[model samples]
Target: MAKLAESNNLVGRVGNAGDTAVGATAGIRLRKSLPWCAAAILGLVGVVYRAILIAVDVPPANSDEGTAGLAALHIGEGRDWPTFFYGQDYMGTFYSYLAAPLVQVFGTHWWTLRLPALVMYAVFLLLVFRLTRTLYSSWFAVFVTAVLAFGSDRVVKDQIIGAGGYSDVATAVAGLMLASALLVLRPEKPRTMLVVWGGLAGYIVWTHWLALPYVAAAVLLVAWVGRAGMTLRRVSLAVCGFLLGAAPLIVFNLRPGRPDSFSVLLSLSGATEPAAWSDRLHGAVLVGLPLSSGLCAPSHCATWQLWWGPTYLVLLVAATAVAVAAFRRADGGGRRVHAGRLALVAGAAMTLAAYVASSSSAMTPVESARYLHYGLVSLPAVLWPLWVGAASVVGKVGSGTSGDHGGIRRRVTGPSLGGAFLAAGCIALAGAFVVGLSVATGQLIAHRSDYAAQADDEQRLVDGLRTAGVSHVYSGYWTCNRLAYRSREQVRCAVLDEDLSPGLDRYRPYRDQVRGSARVAYVLPSSGTMSVNFARSTPALGVDVVSRYELGGYDVYLCRQRPERG
Candidate 1:
């Protein structure tokens, strides 16, 4: 019996040793993979944070946003064809075409409208990371992308006025610009790159006229860089690709009696309000610094307009100096520093200059933040390379000073200025993440209650319209579509502005019918009604308000258009 017991104890001890060995191996592996695990967790958090915002913001906020969602609903029901931006042939029907399927599958809601934007946002992140990793170090890519994701959550928040309809389109165009810049930096086949890039530029013009400046800047950059290699065949192919991409816009606007597309572009182009230098300075500062005051109030951003110029100016100067110093040191330290590596610098610089020139003409009489909303990452994208060059200078120093040629060390763990640089970087990154992110996230939370109340107001207006037996509504171009979509098309609403007829095969004819003899009511938002201005010009026309609904964001009115009196 004693011998048998001893044999069992020996086997048990061997099993225990095997288990301990396995656990120790796992611990080592986990430690090694911690950085990757951290990146994944951060990415997941960003995605979920965006998702939560989309889920909570129930009603659409921007007039354009409502238009896009409503347009998609019409497309799904086969009531409309994929058409360009309502009233403008400058943009393509790409968003509508892409969003229509999702609308059909999920049903129309604020979240459904933003789902495509969310996916595009993810694509933007991946493409930016790939571009950065290709141009610089992996650690640098991770750091910059993390900071951008943290600070720019509002782009995904769906609550901004102008309704963020252009959010995904803007993000997608920016990603295309980055990818195009990457190709220019390392194009194996310059001809193919030209063709691809040209097609993209063409597509961007049709998607959003606002992005055209960046597209033009990129095309110009690539052409200038590849001037030596621009063969006749390559130029022809590139031109063809660009023309082909723009064919839809061209054909649509060429229909008999349609306004000349270029005329329309010119008409829509130019700044309505030329801001003074102080305003210009404020805007430029905004390019570098995201103040808390700049958020929440999408239209005014009154708080953000305060004196942040000095602060950002100082930061820019310091960053530029540090970056130059680091680059010079690294060049001396035997690292290959080619001036050609400065592709992003040229692209982004020109893009900013072009944007300023173009948007200067489009601003309202008062300084508005609408134009700056799309390029939240432009400054960072431009300046991050300097920061990278700065860090590389540190890395070069750390490598030389480390006595630990004995063992592998993490990238930023050296004892000297190497560690100091890392500390500074982490501090700056954390500060940016905290200030921009906290303000944005806090604004989103604060704004949610107001939007929720807007939802109630919209519902009451919907009920009032139904109660009045109002079969059709002629509302401001922006307001008409949302009221129509939310009412599930039971109320066929048409834009009161003749110029803003939606891009649809049936829209013009449908408008003619609705305006002729239908029992049409008028809906006006409290802010201003585009139709009201038009009505004042025609003294013969009369409008009488039968019922009015007042709410937090809008004052709704139900009125009958009385016949003209002699």
Candidate 2:
């Protein structure tokens, strides 16, 4: 019995030994691959979190989303792609055009529409990291990337893929990528970076109009400050690449059967008289910059402005102070590095200024978020250096010091103190993020019932419109789009553009076709155009409401042709 037991024990020991060897080998391999594994995991977590929000769907669908979705569907199904912004013909087509292929594959659903944002954000995160690592340190790069990936600004959340918000935010991020590229790859360096610069420029000019300013400002600033790096090879290559990127947009606009591209560009140049100097100043300082960063302000109220504007102001001030301090502290060669750092902040400010300076066609009394959504992209440029510099400076100064509690030494070392400062900064950011996310989630939860009823109501309204056999739909600028998009192209829909004085015949072809047609639906809000639709719609106009839908927010009116009085 003893001999048999010994034999079994020996076999067990051999098996245990084999398992240990395998685990040790894996441990060594994993250690070698730790960095890659960490990145993959972080990326996966961020993407999956965004995916979940997109999958669940919240904050309800807005008009901009509907416009993009329906237009994408129109393109996917091989109908006439919208030449410009839906209802407004002057806006760029790049956003809707890019999503058409994906909509073709995935159908006209939110997930497919938002998929591009997810992919783009991932790329955005990567580019930010690369840019930071090149300019700063890997540690700082990782820090900035984390804040962006996990930060919960309402603007970013609302603009995420499938949020169906305008394509401005996504394209603006692309613009920032181009700007960052320009900074990292100075044109005069005579490197391969100019090819990248030109290519990116082409994409920017051809994409969102809101984003063009960022890249433009970056190029001009960099070219001026980086005089040493400017070479003929770089200039030629950059310009050629820009032309290549811009070629498609130019060709598309110039095609035999296309909208007059020059007119669109000309119209965008702003008012003939230009905005009042006072209005321009107001917008640049109060409305444009603050609003662009997701700060809301009322015409008569300064309270909100005081709170939000200064918060960024403080950060910007810190960024400037740090840049100057760094420059003063650096030697001759190091001065260029600090100067570039300062230049980024200056470039961001200049971009903001130029955007504000552009004539605003903002029709509303209150500033709209769309006017400055691109600010979200420029934010990281200012934010990254602020955080990194604060941490580094604090770490350097505060390390090797301790509180004097009855002459008791805390035994703090420079490394430990520096780490604590970093931890503290990260924690503060994390806390703010948590609060923002929690508040957003709470809002979504509290309004869950309201949004639920809204969906049911919208679906019901869609069915009602179809049953009425309504062929044409035009609603208040905000209302027309979602219904039309949800109808799956069964009904033509639009919002009247700003320049409707040109007459119906000069507008989108369908508007002219629908005018005087037997069936038309008007989705009017309680205020504007409601009294006119009922009181002033003349008999000769042959317009009257057939059925009216009273929803929680607005009224949907289906019109009928009055019988002719012969």
How would you encode candidate 1's per-residue C-alpha lDDT over 1-566 as one tens digit per residue? Answer: 99999999999999999999999999968864554555566656666767776676632344566667766887888988854766565556677767788888887666777777777666666655555544444455565566545523234432222233355555655565564555444556556666666676667666666666566656665576556656788778877877776777777777898777667776655544455655554454553234322333332334543333344344445544544454465542112121222434444344444444544523431233334444543444444534543455345433221221122222453335665665576456545544655565556556667667777677777777777676676666556666665666666666655433332422444355455532566565666644455345434445565666554345555555643322
Q: Please identify model 2 stretches exceeding 4 Å from their true place.
A: 1-46, 81-91, 150-154, 161-192, 220-231, 252-306, 324-340, 358-367, 384-394, 397-453, 494-507, 526-540, 544-558, 562-566
- Where model 1 places Cα greater than 4 Å from the true spot, the runs are 1-40, 151-154, 157-165, 181-186, 189-195, 224-240, 253-258, 272-275, 283-341, 358-370, 373-433, 494-514, 525-566
Quote model 1's TM-score: 0.71
Clashes of each: 7, 5
For candidate 1, the per-residue lDDT at 351 reads: 41
Model 1 root mean square deviation, Cα atoms: 7.6
lDDT of 2 by residue, 450-490 (tens): 65676666666777778878767665555556765677667
Give per-model TM-scores.
Answer: 0.71, 0.71
CA RMSD per model (angstroms): 7.6, 8.8
TM-score for candidate 2, residues paired by index: 0.71
Alpha-carbon lDDT, every model? 0.54, 0.56
